[model samples]
Target: MPDAVVSGTVYDGYGREAGGGLVLEGGVLARVLPRGYSGEADVSGAFIVPGLVDVHCHGGGGASFPDDVDPRSIRKAIGAHRASGTTALLASLVSMADPLPAIRALVPFCESGELAGIHMEGPYVSPHKAGAQNPAAIRGADPEELAAWLEEGKGFVKTMTIAPEADHAMEAVRILLAHGAKPSWGHTAASGETAAQALEATSRCAAELGFEGVPQTVTHLFNAMPPIDHREPGPVREFLAAARKGRAIVETIGDGVHLAPALVEDIHEWAGANAAFVTDAMAAAGMPEGRYALGGLDVDVREGAARLAGRETIAGGCSRLSDQLALFARRGALPFGQIVRACVAVPARAASIERAKGVTLDFEPGKRPNFVVFDRGFSPVCVVRE
Candidate 1:
């Protein structure tokens, strides 16, 4: 496609939303326009930010990422995510089996542009902190099994969700980092000490084992992970300390239910661009009230909140990425730049893709083809770009 000219308030990397414009071409940014230049999107007044990204997500709408769902269903899920403003995302497959077989199954999706990558959220988590994951599938990562999954993923696995409390978790973290997969801790009940040890191992591996990233992240700061109490610091504390030292990151599910809005503001203050908001979305996102599947069980998406189909378990399900942004904008008491940082820059930093698409995301040599028009309330009025 040729370049598309967009006119509106452009939010370049979390700064005050600009009232200028930009251009998108060939699926990349092509140009950043100035005032009084109009061609494509005549967004007289609207808020335009970079496309959003979701890391730890499950099913969305009524369809779940089950073993039986065909390729068509998965594509439908991705479309639903896009409608919610997620331009790029990882297809997070909840660990049902050993995760190797599923990784092989999902390779086609990632390679074909159906997904960004895989997020193995179990098979090596703590039975106690398993959340809604089937405990029967819980087990330490055997070297043989790990090798099998990594090989099957074939570069499609972008993130690893591990149980920091699992036996030899640190060792497995090393293996994942070695395989070019960014590892984050979750689905485990690790204490402050274990999380500390995991980040410690990450630092050592980066220094001696020739790895890249350091101080592996803690997924979902409080939920699933340990909490922090001044009396005794927990895994959350460990993550805070590492981030404070510019070593680690902390990911959060910004849905008002997963975390209190007040804490969201606090995280942005401490972690800055390191605290990322993950959808942790399941299959019920963008769908009406109904039952859905995740890994191997049924879930219910009622009144826009996902819970166990029949039980009171609040196992995460599909929720829109835009809703996360809206939650912060409404409840976080933050300005435009702060909200944009969590929605754009923060996620980019976590995935190390900031230089490519966030506020500082670099454009190709030609032009910056971009778009998105929203009103004063930040609601989308129009969006059209390559």
Candidate 2:
């Protein structure tokens, strides 16, 4: 096959180079030509980087993933992010009474590639830290029911978030690991001690199952989880310690609305590769400030923050992964490659898609052609998914 070359200041997922070109042949990245190399460049004048992957995204374009079983809504949600350089994403679902019905409906899309998979955020989480999740839908962990729902996705259930302090939470973690899904700790008021215990149990399970190097993650860290009270400490401290030691990965909304600018910089520096960024975006994302729906609840998006209608509680984010990238670029606190690592590389590895289809460790021959091009201002100029 003839090579299709795109040249620019290329950041090949891990490191950045001054100028280079990506070669694509047979629908894969044929090779990466370094600076001064002679290659006919077909695309230029932009920053070329790996396509962003969002492991935690609810919906966008006024389309809610957890609101309906309609495939049209699902396509709209996926399309919104794909257009913004999020070439891959998991369709996150909020807590619900019976998630199997929705999970089943989404299976075809997951298999068909419009969606990555399902991320069940609850129905089994701490009521104390439920945040925007429906309190009435929250329930104690039922391993049997969970196992049934896990199978309903037919391998599309990629990850599930559970509260360490919730009833039978450990059992839920066990079920998640046994079913080939990653279990993340979130939406909890669990003390640091309890969070540590949960980590210990998951560590033992991962070791026994030979899932090493796969660190346990905390969802949208410091948001639904307990805050750092000097005396109590809580999950923040424990999560940070594990992240620093490379035993855990922490997901930050990074939308600025969910975390402070300084804190985001600190986490990126402290956690490094263990730092994973997520959008946790909902229907309001990519839409103008207005009303939207998330998990059957009304949400109001104003000034770039999505909140529960008529309440002060923040529902989720109103930004895409591209917007988050622009947010980081504006700060200039971290290097360009580091920002891509947190937003793309780390999340892809966590989601087990780092070496999956349309992804490659290097811009080398025989790798699928998937990447993004951003203008100098950090806005997504083009996305090449071929």
Candidate 3:
């Protein structure tokens, strides 16, 4: 393969994903090599973060990717996400009564790489934390039905958000894990202790990625369940306290709203680069803030934030991973390197695809960065690259 090198300041350090002079022999990174090598391309002041992953997304741009949405519309939505540098994405699908028809219909396309994976965001959540998901679309989790998704969706199903405290949720979690789908607890009124129990239960169901087995996740951080009371410390708070037995774990949405900049800083200090930054984006992302539909529910976007119409609950974010990184960088909330690592390494770990990621390199303090060429600084630069 011919070598093509792109060089800049290496910001990300996970999955061996470096950002300086990434030596691409074909599309795979050959190495994070010396500067001014024969095939190197230089980009000064640029930072490299992962091509973002959107695990929770509905529509972006002016289109929706749901099965009911048109083919052309889906393409448009995906294109919008691509513009923002999202290389991996999960279709955070909303429910339509029973979701099987749409899942089956979209399977061929998704299997054929129309989407990275599917995240069933609703139809099994608390009505209170349902947010913008259609209550009409909500259903009680049937272990049998979840098993069908595990059977049919297969590798294309990355995650399924369920109300852990709800009926049959643990059974569904077991079935989902049996079929290689990761289970994330969400949209429940689970108390703090219950949340910890739920996490332990899911851990029992899924094989712990780390040596120590633990459910190892809490979706949307401060979003569903209860608020952190000094005495009670709700599900979100308890999940935030996940650290034990050398286990590398903890998840958070870095939309700034999901966890404030200060909270993000706190997480980085505690978890290092292991903390995840998910968009949890909805149809309003990459598009103007206004009215839209998320999972068959009415949503309104005001000031670029989507919320359930006529309610205080947030539906999802209206931004991309790039936007989150930009915000994090601008705020200087955490060390730039750590921020980049969270964006790159954590998401890749979540998807279990660290091997195929960008460039990889190890460095000593004296050495300059190994691989660093991404449009972390300029929008126009990214546009030009394509």
Candidate 4:
């Protein structure tokens, strides 16, 4: 196929180049051309980067991933986020009554590539730190049950969130490692030392099982985990230190509602390349302010924040990656390249779904042509898909 060109200040997903145009032949990137080049399409001053990857998102539009079993509903959720510039994402399922039924139902979606994979966010998490997760569904880690879920997923399940402080934590980590799944620690009350020990054990198991490129990460750090204290630092401090050393990745709900702007900036400075930005959005993402469902829990979206109905605990985000990026862009605290790296490269790498048409989270020549074009305000003008 002949190349179709889209010109702009091209960001190759890691850094910006002088080239202001990108050529797409079919869905693969064909060329990175300099300024003043002519192409099939042109948006000369727009910002261009690879399609954003969301590793941790519940649902969007009016479709809830955990509640809707119909394929059409699942497709609706997928379509909702895709329209907003997320080319790839995992369908996050929270704790529920017998989560396996829902897991089995969603297997086909992942197998067919409607979703990047299934992110099982619960049933094995800590009851103490269960934020929006249903406490009734929380339980101790069971390697046998974990193996069963993996088997049912048929390689469609990419990641699982486990509370590292739970009983049989090491064994659960080993189970996940053996079955080619990454364990993301969250929803815990573990001390820093305990968190470090659990992650170390997982690393050792990965090595013994010949697994590579699998690193430990925390799920929505500081939300489901204890706060950092000078006298009683918890997973937050440990995860930050590990992130700084490139030993781990930390997922942050960068939307200002979940974290302060200054704290978000601190994560960017502290974690550097290991910082991954996620929406953790629910069914209200593209919808107007109203009531919604997130894994069977009632949620209310008010002025951009989704919270439990009549409760103080946050349900999830109603904003998409574009909204989160705009917050950072508006603050002017970080470089453009850094923000794109957090949204695309880092999260994709952490979730193990980075491989896309001969390139992973990048917009270079020979890579898959999936990206979003934004105007000066960072609003998504258009999403280009192969």
TM-score of 2: 0.95
In TM-score terms, candidate 1 sits at 0.89
Across residues 1-386, which tens digit of lDDT does each residue of candidate 2 receive?
24567777777666455347677776677677777555566666468887788999888988988996798888888889989888778889999998877898788888877666788899888899889999999998999999999888887787888888888987888778777787888998888999999888888888887774674787988999878987889889998888888777889888989999789889889888888889999988888999988888899988888899999899988889989888998899988889987877788766666654445345656757668888889988778774
Runs in model 4 lying further than 4 Å from the true structure: 1-3, 16-18, 26-28, 35-40, 43-45, 356-360, 364-367
Task: Give the candidate order by descending TM-score.
Answer: 2, 4, 1, 3
Judge candidate 4 against the unseen true structure and give its global Cα lDDT, from 0 to 1.
0.82
- Candidate lDDT (C-alpha), each: 0.68, 0.82, 0.63, 0.82
- The model with the greater lDDT, 1 or 4, is 4
Residue runs of model 2 more than 4 Å from their true location after superposition: 1-3, 16-19, 36-40
Question: Local error of candidate 1 at 344, Å?
Answer: 2.5
| lDDT tens digits, residue span 194-282, model 4 | 99888778777888898877467778888988998889888888888878887778898988899997898899889988988998989
| TM-score versus the correct structure, for each prediction | 0.89, 0.95, 0.84, 0.94
For model 2, the local distance difference test gives 0.82
Query: Which of candidates 1 and 2 is the stronger one according to TM-score?
Result: 2
> Model 2: C-alpha RMSD to truth?
1.9
Highest TM-score among the candidates is held by which one? Answer: 2
Task: Report model 3's TM-score to 2 decimal places.
Answer: 0.84
The better-scoring model by TM-score among 1 and 3 is 1
Can you write out model 3's per-residue Cα lDDT over 78-156, one digit (the tens) per residue? 6777677665566678755767765665566576665667777767888877766677777778887777765777567
